[model samples]
Target: MSKQRSDEPEIEPFTGPAGGWGSVRSLAEVLPRERVAPDALRQLARQNKPDGFMCVSCAWPKPADHHPAEFCEEGAKATAWELTTLRTTPEFFREHTLTELRGWKDYDLEQHGRLTHPLRYDAESDRYVACSWEEAFDAIGASLRPLDPKSVVFYSSGRASLEASYLYALMARMYGNQNLPDSSNMCHESTSVGLKAAIGVPVGTTQLRDFEECDCILFFGQNVGSNAPRMLHDLRSARKRGVEILTFNPLKERGLERFTDPQNPIEMATGGETQISTQYHQVKAGGDIAAMMGIAKFLIEWDDAALSVGDPPVLDHAFIAQHTKDFESFADAVREANWADIERESGLARTALEETARVYARSEAVLGIYGMGLTQHVKGVENVRMLVNLLLMRGNIGKPGAGPTPVRGHSNVQGQRTVGITEKTELAPVEKLKELYGFDPPTEKGLDTIEACRGVIDGSVRAFVGLGGNFLRAAPDTDAMEAAWPRLDLSVQIATKLNRNHLFPGKVTYLLPCLGRIEEDVQASGPQAVSVEDSTSCIHGSRGKAKPASPHLLSEPRIVAEIAKRIAPANPRVDWDGWIADYAGIRDAIEATYPEMFRDFNARLFTPGGFWKGNKAAERIWQTPSGRAEFLAPGELNATGFADADGRFRLMTLRSNDQFNTTIYGYHDRFRGVKGTRDVLFINQADMAKAGVEEGQIVALESDAGDGTTRRREGLIVTPYDIPRGCLGAYYPEANVLLPVEHHAEQSHVPAAKSVPVRIRP
Candidate 1:
């Protein structure tokens, strides 16, 4: 390690295990500072409970038998962040001009806290002024009424409830608008697209109990420590039970290495930690497809050898012959694969691949778990399919303790998609929607996140309605998107807190404050409970017990319903007012729309751990065109073509331990040993040495997309760490500037955030 300067961020290895006193310390530090210490504590007590709200964090599933404290460190931050006492009232906005606020950091902007009233931008003064809800809604209606429906974008974030999302989707369709771009478009859209193409279902097949039963679990590119800390409990228990856990990522994430369960009193008392991963492989960034192919090749060759000797088959030939299609083509591709290329591209030796394959062959049951690391790539869709290919080789799908599980990021991202907040017209229940709402939903494909960005840039999109989320910050090419944001004729954001997205005022802009998920929402009908679908496809009810941040703040359903009533064409059959009055009515409509999946939705919602929306693939029922699981393979070994032959590094943007998505809770990343800054880069020690770059050396990175446009981020301090050679890591939203909006996954169109071809600016 090189010597650090005084101005450099505090950098050191975190020796402590994940989720011990570190989590406690973080919560302790954040709560009081946010001035929500008492109230947030009360809310945290009920988080993830049967009668309480779902955590406003990652979409990790809740166990049937819930722990007394089910929320994690990040979840606690989310709760405290929302339950903050700091208020961004009309007077607060009056003090800060839009131009001035636009120059502030994302963290500083949000520190002003929960939005108290509806606000409209005053271009004359270059500031936001307080406006009545009626004025805001009318302005939105006036702006939206004249625009072509196709010119409008209804962007929903994962934080919005299913009820709110349903209303938003319905409103968009009623107005003949098809664009329903959302947070999912940036993260797990590849998982949905790939899984649907391969298995007919778009969601993960494994239930929470599968963790207990699986003999082995393979994790890909997911950092469970920071992103989904609650998952540590399951992994710790699985480790204690002697299950083999294997991890593949550019960084050897501390969470996957070992975990000290905060919930385990004995472990907490003894300061004991459970060793998590049996083998942690630091694979090259964007090399998941290559690595997956190598594993499959080894397995196939082993099976071939066994078959030649007339030995018991290593592969599940019965499962393949009966339940799958196009196996021979996939096998042929694997057979034709060269071991040397696979080894070189994946940055793993052949021995390691063979050993991983041996583990898979011997295990009776295995769970294939992954996150955006596999999905946010040039070949993201192929990456997901390749993982599924490995699982299908051992008859993993449609079996207990087995299947591909995409660990989703947000609390209700999957639920938002389930409720029809999608750009894909086919995903919506059009016939059912028409019957319910008396309108023909738009059949044309809508703009996804990438297309939405393009639409805004080219001035095709006239309006942008955000249900929630920091759209510009979460998007690729952050600076470009932010610059292009003002091009929209109208911009409306329904959110809980003040963020930088709201500062980028459009020609006609409005900021509508909505109730946070952890705050009490008392509609006209009475107290209401919203539902969210977890990563496991379990639909559960979430009811807030804490006091509202402000009396003026409206519930998400009400805000969406009010906006719909104003802007959307009148539908006598649809009762938006009644649905807002009672969220149960919304649930009833959801059941009517997706009858097969949500039958008895309201009745089953409050059940201890909610009801499972069963996966068709898990039943060995493939809904593909051939009525069988399709074995798809990428055309080549260098799937992304982000080779290091030209000395360009594959950059994967990451979230700090203190951050959740674009929400910067603090400047500390406890796991990776970053502190007081988000602008540092993590490069391999050897790579840094070879490049003559010292630790804490300020450097610049520029995109090498060969598009003649320079996407660069400067003044980043290079920090040598345990990342793979030819790979570099930087925090997202900060590094998002380095990714071009056009560089995204094929077929899915999700931003290729995990693998961007870039070079260090000397």
Candidate 2:
């Protein structure tokens, strides 16, 4: 390991429960720093409320009877970030060269604040010059119109609303190809792929209210308090009702252990924490498949024992027989699974797995909740399938408080996919588009984030249009991506704030500032409400109540419509002007396309808490090829796409308590006892001594992919943490450099950020 560093971050054990006075103090500290502090507070009060805007942070569902202060700590920060009075106008760009801006950190770049005008890169000045929206649109249209549809990529972030996403996808399809890739490709794409094969639906089965009814909630690889603090309210309520909470992760997350409601006065005043997890197991990184199989194995063996004794069956045989298929193969796979391998891979004692199984067996209703930690693996899809298989053993699907829940990141990522922002043309509204507009949609497959990046590197994709996200930062293999990004012919970013991705301007680049979700979106008709679908497939309206950060800022829907009208062939049938004039027209179009799920879209959208699209899996109506729930088996315990090499450890990237996705709010990771710095690695004490690394030692990490390319991240301070012995943790974006671009899941192609084989070195 490298020599010890003198400038070390303040590290201490966090003994307090999550979301107590600590959370309040965090919000209090940040709220005052925002230039629009008073406005942000006003907006926070309206967040997630009826007729108000949705939180721009995580996609945790809001309850029907929303809290007076519906926003959480992170949500409040996101609001403040959006509502900041700071501006990055043409003057700001002129003052700082692209090269100078490129050297700045991601957080510092965004802190310069929201973009106030449209800008075009000027090669002579090495700066972005202010331009009229029409001029920018015309330039973009000219560049895009002549290109082959397959050569262009449209990237959408989860921050986009359903209206904007709908138009964005429609524009791409109308323009002829579906080179549509978004944030979902990185986070929960595995859940979509896995659940569709197993349970027929691509979303979580439980509604927001199901947490109250569930007998047991099993959490796998999710840090609810940090990612989506609002979910803690439900978890705390479930705990109070005597529901069992079991957690399996590489690190014993503070959120999954205990949480005190910041909203509840009694708990906040008393500092009383409601215990979250009944059992917390520190499973190995990328060992979710093995851990899941171990639980399933125990249940299967117990069922066999019951059957042999002529006693009551442990498995839900009646439900399984009537509602599932391929159970025998899955059961046989679990039966043949080696206990030694399970014990080794999962890093859990057999007794612990058995005890978890016992609790699962007795529970009348069980809910499996997970996040990117389970999905960002080489076998990410299989990892999800294994969890689904465990749930299927007890017929958890199609029942109240019983199903697999993939907690989603971003506000509207699922909604983006729902609105046809995907490379999969089959998921697009092919027939509807044909009927509505006189054009043939491209039948050929388009590119996802991974394929798109490769296309850029190889010179196939010449153009990139991003709708609200720090794409380059969120992507794996950061260095390669940065080097290859400038190769694109045309690049456009429609966003609220300036990010690192904007610094790497293309040959012909345009930065189009757009209104934030928290800002008012006024059209020709009046103030418009856009809809977004939550993790549970519940679609709701979010009408911005806060003032626009800039007068020049255009709504996303309007920008997308303008681009569509300019780039796409003129079609009298496609009423782009009308859609921008009244967002209800867009909703009507969506309803017409997806009639079943979005019937009376406009009417139901304004209803309190909006409407649930409803999952067929919850009703025991499987749409799978087998016409029933599936029991697919994951054959291998090693899902990192590589074997255990000598002196190599499994590393997973983490988000700090003060961060959300790639948007860094501050350096402190209070949950992990990290302060004033993010460049720290969390390793177990045993692993530290084993590797000859001590606390405060600045080390470097090199990928063990052996792909001839060196992927390394240096200047990391080692800190002993409560992680598994062979597992290590570090913050993302910084660690993203260590991941190879090609290293992704077998089926989903989602980046394997949760498990990367690496060596700590000097």
Question: Could you tell me every candidate's TM-score relative to the true structure?
Answer: 0.98, 0.99
Q: CA shift at 261, candidate 1, in angstroms?
A: 0.9
Per-residue lDDT of 1-762 in model 1, one digit per residue for the tens?
244454747888889989898988998899887898476777788899888899998999987798988899999999989988999888986788988887798899888788888899999988888889999988899999989999999998898888888888888888887799998899999999999999999988999999988999999989999999999998988888999998898898889888888888898899999999998888888878888898899889889999999999998999999999888899999999998899888999988888888898899899999999899988889999998998888899988899999999989999999989998888988888888777888898988999999888888988999989999888888777888889889999988888878889889999999898888889888898999989999998999988898888898889888888887877788898889888999999998999988999988988887799888999999989999999996776655645565668898899889989989999889998888888798899898878778888878899998888888998788888888888899889889889998899988989998889998875
Q: lDDT (CA) for every model shown?
A: 0.88, 0.89
- Cα lDDT for residue 495, candidate 1: 87
Residue 166's lDDT in candidate 2: 89
Off by over 4 Å in 2: 6-8
lDDT of 1 at 50: 85
Question: What would the TM-score be for candidate 2 when compared with the true structure?
Answer: 0.99
User: In candidate 1, what residue range of length 10 has the lowest lDDT sum?
Assistant: 1-10
